[model samples]
Target: MKLLLSFFLIFPLLLSSQSFEKGEKLFVEGKFNQAQLVLENYLKSNPNHLKTLEYLGDIAGQNKAWDKSISYYKKLENLKPTEANYYFKYGGALAMKSLEVNKIKALGMIGEVRSSFEKAIALNPKHIEARWALIELNLQLPAIVGGSESKAIKYSSELRELSPVDGYLSRGHIEEHFNRNTEAEVQYKRAILIGGSKVCYQTLADFYKNKMKQPDKANKVWEEYKNKNNKGIK
Candidate 1:
């Protein structure tokens, strides 16, 4: 009888596991709305399901629902304060929100954004994304707030140690921001050569289109990028 009771007790957990697996598979298959519904329903019964919360946060981010993303990530932050990725995601969402708000509100939110990235790096020193995000944020803000090219350079140095391609990209962003077209082009080209990511290709293409005044070169690069991606389609 006790063994039978144990089986009954375990059955609900088994169902929950199956449900979560199905939801996660749906998410991976790009059925994000369906996955969100399934996961949200699951979270009703399992309120503290950290994985579900994380996915909800990511889904919100994909949908560009910055407020929802912030809520979900903040919950995850409270649940797992030591998690570096949660802070990074939370900061990113907040930064996005800042852009939608007025200047005064954006100023405060920007500070929070920087603080979150700082915490993320403090938790995981080698977090390349967090480091890069911080560098970009510092470069954009004014000197009165947190804008410091020197700080951006420091983070760029650390990123260089972590990833040469990302280091070049950061330097390119710095140069581009300061309107140094020739230097920016050189750094961006080096970044593309070092890393074959879509961001690298797009960055150089944009530089050519806008800064270099070489629309033909930009069109060629963009066409090649589209062709390369289309080849991967099933």
Candidate 2:
């Protein structure tokens, strides 16, 4: 009778563990809908599960349900105050929500969004995405409000110190925004030479096609990328 009671006690815990693993696997496979069902069920039993909350937050974000995403991430922030990424995600959701709202509301949200990203950086100096968010945020906001090319450059400088590729790409983006096409092209080329990643190649190609209005140059860039990859396959 004691043995039967122990099995009954342990079985539910084992089942919950399996359910959690299955939910994580579904999330990784990009089956967000299925993952949500599994994770939501798991969360009912494990209310304080951090990873489950994060996955649910990510799924909500993927669905563009910004309010739901923000709620989950806020809970995460409250539960795990020390984690830099929770702050970042909370800030990102706020930023995206700002876009859907009116300008006045967005202006109101700017402080919180900036502070969240700032908090992430304060917690983890090496947090790349938080720095990138700041760079874009600074660039996108109008000068009348708070935008500053100098501030964007400051983040770009930090990115350069951490990752040269991101630094060059971001600098190129800033230069392109300012219509300094030659300088932007130089930065993009340097990024290509240094990073040689798909993003680097695509950024340059899109710049050529759209910004520079040189389709032939874009085609040539793609050809070069294809040739390089083909050689690696050989």
lDDT of 2 by residue, 119-205 (tens): 999999999999999999999999887888999999999999999999999999999989999999999999999999889999999
Clashing pairs in 2: none
Task: Summing lDDT over every window of 10 consecutive residues in candidate 2, give the lowest-scoring window.
Answer: 225-234
Q: What TM-score does each of the candidates earn?
A: 0.87, 0.97
- Model 1 scores worst on lDDT over the 10 consecutive residues at 225-234
Candidate 2 error regions (>4 Å): none
Clash count, predicted structure 1: 0
